[model samples]
Target: MKIGLFGGSFNPVHNGHIKIAEFAYKTLGLDKIYFIPTAISPFKKKNQVAADNDRINMLNLALENFNYNSEVSLFEIKRGGVSYTFETIRYFKKKFPNDELFFIMGSDLLPKFHKWEYVEEMTQSCQFVVYKRSKNINKINAKKYGIKIMNNPIFDESSTKVRQGQLALVDVKVNNYIGNNFLYAKEIIHSLLTAKRAKHCVAAAEFAVLLAKSIKYDAKKAYYAGLFHDICKELDENESRAFISQFVENAYDRKLFPNYKLHQLAGALWFKHIYMNDDEEIYNAIKIHTSLALELSTLDKILYIADKICDGRAFAGVQKLRQLALENFDECFKQVVQRNIDYNLAKNITFSDEQNEINNKWSK
Candidate 1:
């Protein structure tokens, strides 16, 4: 039978992983698939992993209700060492010598495949199926390695971005998917009636939504993520961490970058505390809005950058970023980020790697 092998840390699975898997099932006419999450990965530092059981549970939570035949493989967990794709492929090869096994991975990873451990052995053993990351991005030259690419795929929705606290304005599909059915705009209205801190949340929410819209983001999620951004800042660190712990169970997504007292994280928790349940997208946008910049989702950038550029805030160079917000979005984004970097440079404050990457990508 033809099958695909999808493996990753799945520190916490995000919508993109599920979307790609679904795409594979529909287009590839696969018979079945195995999601083999590594017990540990050696490529990077050991991520701050939740228990293997917890990781598995979150995946199970994420994978529910798919029509395709699928099963979570436990081989990596059973072996219990730094997980390598080559090693896993070897095991699968031995188990299914005659079966057609396609390995699914992203375009970004394909460039580095040749550098992998026993790369020749792995590539020769199985056919490679690749997917485009963003509509704007394209891959070339990698096809020489026997790679077949998937077209018109969504990029930027990555687990790495999720962990680092980057949030965006969620769109309607995401809003409806939440199951609660309340959009961020409605959530803001509700939070106002309930919380005393809700007053400032309006301005915060406005700034976030405006920024997201300026950047062409989903306005609804941006509004709510912004509205709830500062709802938890008044809480103590222990309370904040507790809130984060309660809300963001995606361990890998949580650790790709550092977590500071970013409002997105707090806002997400406040959503659950007041609302009883959450849309996964909103919860994540809140969870990671500080660091990971992937997807640049509407609420993510709006809440992070808008907190500074909005009209009411009195700060140095406020006129520049604010003035440029509508006129030239990219310039406005770069200026806001440049000001932050210049400010840090003056004080010699250690800049986050994320902040650094932001400066580089936008300013460049």
Candidate 2:
């Protein structure tokens, strides 16, 4: 009988992790695989990154989709120290003495064999299986290490790349902590935003999705943020004003708020007021898209730019702004800010602190 030992931080085990185990199952003819997330990695600080519980949660989510490739063992994470692979291998050997052990890893990490404790003895303890990762060719100095390489599981991926992605098909990245934690609103949230605003929201969602895809931000989360950016825009002036009054108290009515900016604040308030769905991410996007939103999220940046450049907005130079959004976000933002500033100046309209704060923030 042969069982595989696949262990790592599993910290948010993503699609890549699942792929490796899946490939290993077929290529190496393994009976079962265990996904062990490190509690305290010897290589790095535990607190400096997501906590074990968070990673565990993402693992739960990954397993929900993968079902077979993921299972949780508190062994190393509960032990709370540097997780040396030798210690894990020894324990698994004791548990399944009759089963053949195949330790799966990438070809690159094989060189650090000497660094692992009792390296000489560990090699004889289990059959090591190295997989070619990335574009790196299958170059296994197996005879020297008394190991073999699995050509089938040679996936071009890593945990680093998974975390950097906005979305993954079958990744361990959706562990218990981040498991389905994305914010969402069901019905009214959609009803509240205007057709024009809804179009912008969808565009912003797509824009944020594209950016997150580029940088590996969470597409699920970014998409929700985009769809809800203007969720309160459809609220009547009185209802919208009432919602804003709770946060921006100055005996301020909706009329006091600027048309260009009232929607942002209103959207944030309405989500909590109506849906009992309070979200900091959604609030941030809604509050910041008007004037010159501050400290923008990937989703916020998309909505802000989309509002300025959406096809429905016939404002001056919108075509150019949309074109610029593809290449230069900052420049596009500056142009929007400058246009608003000039518009206010020409109309002799009074500015609010929100407007002033945004204008100052974007200038930086």
lDDT of 2 by residue, 182-240 (tens): 31232323444455666767776776565455556676666666666777766666776
Measured on C-alpha atoms, candidate 2 has an lDDT of 0.65
What TM-score would each prediction reach against the true structure? 0.49, 0.52
Task: Give the Cα error of residue 287 in candidate 2, in Å.
Answer: 5.7
Q: Report model 2's TM-score to 2 decimal places.
A: 0.52
RMSD of each: 19.2, 15.0
**Which 10-residue window of candidate 2 scores lowest in summed lDDT?**
175-184
lDDT for model 1 comes to 0.65
lDDT of 1 by residue, 285-312 (tens): 6665554354565455556576666646
Query: Residue 349 of candidate 1: its Cα lDDT?
Result: 76
